[model samples]
Target chain A: MKTYSIVLLLCLLTPYLGNAQENFIFKKAYDLKVLGRVSEDTSHFQRIDSADLQNLPPAVQRYAKFSAGMNVVFKTDSKSIKIHWKLKKMNTLWNMPSVAVNGIDLYGWNGQEWQYISSGRPNSEDNQMIMVENLDGKMRNYRIFLPIYAEVKDLEIGVLEKTTLSPPDTALVPSSKIAIYGSSITQGIAASRPGMAYPSILSRRLDFDFINLGFSGSGKMELPIADLLAKIPAQLYILDCVPNTLPEQVKDRAYPLITRLRMLKPEIPIIMVESVKREISNWNSAMYTRVNGQNDEYRKTFDKLVAEGYQNIYYISTSELMGDDHEATVDGTHLTDLGFMRISKTIERYIKDSIAPLQ
Target chain B: MKTYSIVLLLCLLTPYLGNAQENFIFKKAYDLKVLGRVSEDTSHFQRIDSADLQNLPPAVQRYAKFSAGMNVVFKTDSKSIKIHWKLKKMNTLWNMPSVAVNGIDLYGWNGQEWQYISSGRPNSEDNQMIMVENLDGKMRNYRIFLPIYAEVKDLEIGVLEKTTLSPPDTALVPSSKIAIYGSSITQGIAASRPGMAYPSILSRRLDFDFINLGFSGSGKMELPIADLLAKIPAQLYILDCVPNTLPEQVKDRAYPLITRLRMLKPEIPIIMVESVKREISNWNSAMYTRVNGQNDEYRKTFDKLVAEGYQNIYYISTSELMGDDHEATVDGTHLTDLGFMRISKTIERYIKDSIAPLQ
Candidate 1:
């Protein structure tokens, strides 16, 4: 009789043991908040069709389009979770299908093979909110792969049946977060694969997050974008819109752009990026002068920022970005993947030792 | 009789003006030497085709494919002429056609517009020596822009038209050279234009000569490539090949790569680069292990080198490069142009402060 009891006990505990061994579980859900309004013009927003959210990886599963002011409630049974986000104003440029929220493909390993979960797309209506759910519960440690610009008001968590709530992990590991604001390059255009870009490589090296606000050719350091950037947080902000801007425009906008960012995030590091040199030597007769002039203006702004008790502002010389040996660049404008990596490494080191510690 | 007398007076006076503006012409031709060969097979050595030489910028007119051997020669009538060059190798899977240099194209600035002179596809069997001649005597300060690899052993100038050589009113300034070696990102893949690549931008900022030997997916720190790199004189040698190599591979190669470069050029500054993190989760899996292993190996190597009296080596963590945010990357690997600019600035400052002085 005792032997029979023992067997039954073992049988009863087998299911529990299996559940424990399956470590992957959802933890908690949060209410994703958006402070903006949906544009009345539906054409200005992106409408996501019914797709398989399960196809996306956990990192990007929560990215879904919704109307503005709509609450995205994420539910999980896990305890504490980390959050990251970004936001941008809706404009005509943002309405294009190609300009929708990109770089949100997520993947996870299912022991033997990697599986996809979900992806993010622009909302169909401007000023609408895109929300994600089941993020914290889906993975133990969560990472939102896309650059989200909405306001993150609060997070909610709950302990599972066999789990307990724990404090968030905040270890001082060597990490970095670079915020890139520019045009198509910032949007990962023309790369053979998404991961082959320099920024992606840099992120892999640094063990940090990235906020890419590249809006195709539409990204400029305009007031609307800068205002949006002011709300989110980052360790460094890289401004690289000169390529899309005319020289006169750069000259007119460079100083104001730096000043705006400095005013918002006084202590964060800001690296002003210049446009790459053109392959066509004489494409723009005033390119040299305009670039030089904009550079000088940036310098002046940096100096001014430094003078105004903002110590982390710096200017990255445009020449060092490409053509150092003149072989890394493709047409004197865009870089090959190798060129991007070379340039990213150079900047990665500077930010790690020189900029991040200040934060 | 009066016209002949006037012409004689003009001719006599012309000599005085020509002599006044005479520039010093070094007698010996510039000696451009090929250091050594780097190829999987020596039987198919890469050589510069003379026909292709006509396609280079007016400044870099030469016939010489860089091949293994120290016997290559470069002759110039002026001691300081702009050097331009092009080299070809097999393109990789991840390489984009926009960034590949399969043939040579010539560009010239015609005061008001830039003109395409010629383009040539190199025939493997051609034994033509590249040549650069001053077709127009009006080219006062010959500026040579080398788009490819052709080493300069020495430089010389010679008198033309029997005129005595004197220093020209303006002198050619030799920009500090920055050499970078890495994978596809370093090769400037996906960049919309060549100048948009970070390395090129950095060059423009620093006014430095750039040598971009970024091989797409080929920067595995192989000994042959390193051997090639060792022969080139540079202010800085950036090793950013981690993204192209698996973490395990990086672990195996990082130390040896650094050690070999140090062995070849003891005094040159070698910046060791760490791989960037992927936006995808599963941070504790093979990717993390590989990256961390490589990074640890690099650190250990750096420490060992420093312990062994190598003080010039530096480390740039990937974290600092990408910042803590996750949006900078386009598709978990490559960077948007904005990301490229950020990285370019970071490295530019480091080069300016750390390596520029040495150069």
Candidate 2:
């Protein structure tokens, strides 16, 4: 009877309560458990080490500063979530959506898998938006993926004042990670949001973390990039740079880059991915010949390495990469969220087979 | 011997020839066979009639002017194709890619299916881009889907000089069409490109044209819209406006709209689609309740109409609309290309079964 009266009193006062923002307690996202990063010394949410910028290409250095695949993980019992983030600049790409380039994507762990909650829409450089509201106030695990192609200055998460907000008590993420190195597609150019990138999708499905070393328009299998990648420790490495590299460049550089990486990280596995067929190649004979030539060169290099007895090296072909229908990309070159899902599904099996024994 | 000499001569001169655009004859897109439009009285590419704007809601009138699912069909033997278009104004949505909003999507008839070729990327109000080059100079059928959410002032298509460029002689598109009416998702919001929208996707796969009457934020099942939809002659009609209508609004407005449409277009099939489950509803209590309530109300209205002896009315549940995974949308609300694919595939079977007898 006493509980009934309290419920009745709460129901009566529910109409009078207004402006939920006034009841929130804001916390810096930096204090939370961060994932999808290799280095922790950086003050901001950048993917690459700033100290190594001098050795990298100009485009790589600039692309590295953008938070491509970094995300924050925490558990909260707040009825609502509000996110406020400051981007260094409003860097909206022509082909990609602003939500993917600068906005924040939120996901919640629903016992079985991480389900999408909502997105924080970015209207300006300094933007604040509510992710979700009027929840049941139950303790839930949440991860918020940062901007895919924008430099984040700072971020804060707001929850109800009375609710508890803290890091995970159990092991939600694995200690070892899968590091991917590739071009603009890997950098999440045309994904609807950051979390929809192939690496992020694979991470969520496989319950692992991925260090995305994707440099936009600069994943050309350069020796400097190879040197940098070899230094970052990981369970496996994915090289998807054939799209950006010319056929001659592939034939010239694939051997040196693979040999150097294999020499440095002998115990780890490296999976070489062939570039997916460009959609325009269906009609345009030039793209068809060019892409096929690039893939042929890449395959020959992979076969040569296999012949040389590289034990830990693996190869992933482009047959089932983006499916039979070539409607996976926005432009003929870059993968959309649909393409990302197909690629992630295709690559997930290879990742699982390679990493199981090591894990 | 003569063919071999000609081939050798062409190969020799290939290196010297520069700027392929210089050897092209430009033709206005309006002269070609236009598809996915109901009225051709308008001077430009528009889905809806300007004469009907006074009867629509203010937002609907504004949205109707945009070329959402319109396309031009032409046959060309040119080695390359170039497109130049002028937009009334640049209308780039934050969540949607500009390629989808303002750019053109090209597809080719590859015997069995319409395969993706390339997309013309939009940069500004006046934009010109090369769609493809270096083809085999074979006679090929092509369709270029117009911008999904931008107004086209004028459009021109260019083909190589001394090559045949004309409209399709064969019936590439059927005279009878499938007309769809819905909210922003149906209006092609957040798709990777214009061709990736559900109606456009279905049209290609089903081998039929579709009149897209999707209005952003204005598909409220208004009496005026039903009156307008009833007048358009088509093989079938689809009502997918549950996402934009309130539960009470569905209960109040749905019966009147459906009855009016059925009364006017007595022979055509009317498919009522339930609102797709929003991704945010998985966690947000308010959205969960609201969306479920709206669907329930919509379903109940359909059941009532069925019980009252409506013969040609059909109902489609939200069972497999966007798949089980909630990654189909950029936000929790609007669909991405992945979501559009899922929706199109799910709805295709129902459309095929309904329109088969009529055809």
Candidate 3:
């Protein structure tokens, strides 16, 4: 009689329990854990967020919010995953918001390397919902890449009950990292999804962490942006801003930005890259002049740095960036997903050599 | 005074010329020359078009119109290229209609292989426009891949005025060639655009014309479609239907289709493929069972064929499909553009050797 009475009371309260669960969906949402940047106690989860948006110049301020080549790492064992997020208003003349997976993609580690899991995009507007069901319910490391050409207004990850979640292993997600700064190619102009971008590809293959300071057409190595990057501590600094700069501009700005970074983080390893030659440029005369000039100026800057007795600074030439067959780009300037894969494979050895051994 | 008057009259007629050009956009447009298929004079551009759409089972007919791997090759000296097209309404769960470039991408030969020039997806609805400007003025060979997951109601290509256009060379567009039939992977589920699809990639790399008979989920080696395919003459037959079949279904359907094709065209090379394994399947036991079971049955079919004294039948094992690191997919099953590249690389050697050397 006692057991029957208890069962009757539980059935009577089922509707109230369902209502509680519904309310909790939005009211008690968990913020997705983001690493590879400064602490969030300052209320900053992305590289460029509310605090610094106002400080940027109007020209680059728009790109600053794009969340280009940003990443977040953690570990989770969720049976299913849901992302409640909004796409940023950011867009380019050549790229659309939807083609970039609304600027987010996720991958999970399979005890060895990262494997793609899913991405977030919904056809509906205002409130987009992306739900991934039937995940392998095992303890796996997870990584989420932010949009390359768009910003995330807000994003939260929902997991099933009692799924064990933790931070990434320190070996892979190093406390300090190699920081990369460059133009649209480095910002992942045409990668299919955010994580497939060259920087993210390098991070996955080499097992390291990085901050991509790629700013689409505007990554001209301005001193103001360099000032913000200098504030962060990293083991190596990679400068890839030659593509967006003219020879005259690189002569004026590239060395100064490198100088500023070196002063702030002296004795750190620095790797600078010449602009990747566009495949079409081989035939287009005007393009050939521009590409060849960019390489000449970038090499000049490297020579100047060496002459000044700069130690542990390195350079990667233009020929090494693309294959001899030249099947590495979507447009003449921007990289496709295959371009990113080829570039990461081409430059991995040079990139790895520049890294100082972990203590 | 006469010379001045003539120049003034010429300037006055410029708007009229512009209006004439506008009228010619669709009215005087040239039907894009399609290669790699049997003649459509029998009113069949694909395996089955409007002529026989009524005859196919409702389920298979729904997928037949998607134009899974159809390609058109042409040469033009036009300074600019334009495409006017409408999207076929075939779509998948996660991939949107607009996400797949709505089934079209174009590339130009750069003396060796295909270089991605551009892909088309106009934001506006109905009568989308894709205009590629400032192309090299010299005669350039071009290849346009039709939709992988969608079919077109009608399509036309427009080049700049006074440019020469011609059909592909006979050497490149061979008289007889390979024909491939398979599932959605064979139908290109997640390539960034149609040209990157494996069949198209193989077609370009091997320099051989092919008829791509990949239907989305209906590649169960049904006798009806096989009957239609058997009528077409090809140098080789490639069967990649393992992904869309259960072991029991394979045991029942695969052999009959092969036997039928053999009876129709003897002494042709037939290459069978095992389903490409997914990275997530390593831990998902149910998925592992499905993938492994499919492979076992496929191998069994190959062994049985050899035992029956069938010569020139080849089998491609699954281990070659993905790298040991297993980072070759977009989701657990669908390939990203990189995955497609890795796959095209993995199987190119086998597929190439099967091709009789180009005369």
Candidate 4:
């Protein structure tokens, strides 16, 4: 009778004892190998230089602070993963879910490809949540993508007791980057999650680091942004800013930006993208005229640049970006996960076929 | 000089005059030809019978009021579309965007196919917004899908003052319905917008009314739900409730539900679907076991039914639903637009090849 009672007592206390033994070893994100950054900002996860904030426009500065394409890559042999993160501020978007705007997307490398495990769903400015658990506890490579539209104030990764968590022995992605500069779409405005963004998807598919320099409402090929792009040393540069630039702005700004970027990086490949066709323009005549006008002006600029004997320069039209079904966007403008995937596949084809580094 | 002054004054008053002349005629949703309904509840936009609500579980009753897959189809010559809507209550989900949970999706049929125009982004319980403006003044077919997760209190459509807003000259979709009963996924839990739900996508592609009988957490193949489903006069019935039912529950309940449904509707075709393979299960052993166990029990029940000489019955496995990549879901469970599109395409292929009515 005493043996049975003792056994029952031990069973009742097993869960609590196991929980007590879960000694979590937390690692600051600053100590990890971060990807998709061109500037060394003071903030741990920002995309651009902290010093450039004062010189740039307010919107650009604010958007640059978001860790749109930043991710931390590490190796761990833990059965569980947990995160305690604090956002710079609590932000909400009408068309974007909080999971995309303020969440952590974790993926595990399964030999050949990265597979999604879970997302850290945020509840407030500061949140602590278990991302995934009950793993087989093999030493494996893992990448955790940061929030696409919000800034992280602080981040710490937690693993089970006595588990090994260290920097990866080999570089998973190449050091050479494909830097993309564009509008809100490039900034991943309406992706279902951060990892579904076009740049992140392309990085996973192409096995290269793709830097995101997308500035929401500010990717107008302004000289300030162009100068910033010229400073980043990348193997390839893709300019996809026609959607955010007016026709007159395109004619005025496209030539100087491309020319300066060419002078700065003499032999690097550069691809120019036209404004994507908007489904709303199918019915609204005014929007049709405006978007088509922007594209025409952008095309003229590209023709002039080609005539000037620019080498290793290319242009991509809108015809091949989003599919013909017109169901890829949440609003008439912002691309959803479907749109992001479609666009990324198109870009991936270009990178694989034309760019020597990726090939 | 006096004539010039009058011309300038007229030009200054043009916007106000146009605004005053832009009279809108409003129509209640009850006056339109609505689709994807099995019951004639007093509410203009509910899926189930109001009387049956008292007898069902609270979760099922609450979910029944949500007008998932319900849409209004009409023809109009108005150059713009506007809406004034009220919700039963303001609700929010961690994984779903507000635009999907509470917004309205509008699609206009061109000569060949339906094209997405814009989404009515909701602000509060009582909301008014212009869905689309500056459309070409042509008599066109339009369909407006309602919120997927929120119940509607009242809805009204507005068009140009003199333009006709009448029922479609011919039925755009067939009269026969394909009733799909399942969990929150069938209710379009994490879709980016209302029209991206699998049922909505299938309706557009197949041109048939695909009814949504999904209860969020209550799709346990209960006898009451089975009886309710049996009463609906559908040409085909798809049982997709395995995700919400445990192995034991499925073993105890699936046979009775199928047998009862078959006994009532002898000729109607039935399709039983295995639970979808969740990406979370790839790394988590507990989830892997649970989901796989549910599918195994469901398959056994299906095999039993087929062996018992059940004619016009079929089964669908989970292998071909979401793509090999694990990026289809916002969470590891509820699908995003990408996942919804993929799953809908898979189902569409099955229907086209197997279902006689659709073919």
Q: Residue A289, candidate 2: how far off, in angstroms? A: 2.3
Q: Return the TM-score for candidate 4, rounded to 2 decimals.
A: 0.93
TM-score of 3: 0.83
Residue-level lDDT of model 1, residues B76-104, one tens digit each, is 23312222232443221112232222223
Candidates' lDDT values, in order? 0.43, 0.83, 0.63, 0.81
Among the numbered candidates, top DockQ falls to 4
CAPRI verdict on model 2? acceptable
lDDT of 4 at A175: 70
Is 2 or 3 the stronger prediction by TM-score?
A: 2
lDDT of 2 by residue, B1-359 (tens): 56643433332112112245366788988788888877866666888878877888998999888999898889999888888899998887888888899999988888787888888878899988778777788898888999989999998898988998898756686677888999888999879899998899988888677999998876989988877887777889999998877777788899999999889888889999998887766776655766687789999989999899997888899886989888998887788999999999888988988877865
Pick by TM-score: 1 or 3, better one: 3
Candidate with better DockQ, 1 vs 2: 2
Q: How close to the true structure is residue A202 of candidate 4, measured as C-alpha lDDT?
A: 87
TM-score of the A chain in model 3: 0.84
Give stretches of model 3 more than 4 Å off: A1-33, A42-44, A53-55, A76-100, A120-140, A168-172, A357-359, B1-32, B42-47, B82-100, B120-137, B356-359
Instruction: Give per-model TM-scores.
Output: 0.40, 0.94, 0.83, 0.93
Of the two candidates 3 and 4, the one with more favorable DockQ, higher being better, is: 4
DockQ of each: 0.03, 0.40, 0.20, 0.43
**Tens-digit lDDT track of model 2 for A168-205:** 64677667778899988888888999899888888788
Worst 10 residues of 3 chain B by lDDT: B11-20
How many pairs of residues collide in model 2?
Answer: 0
lDDT accuracy of residue A156 in candidate 2: 89
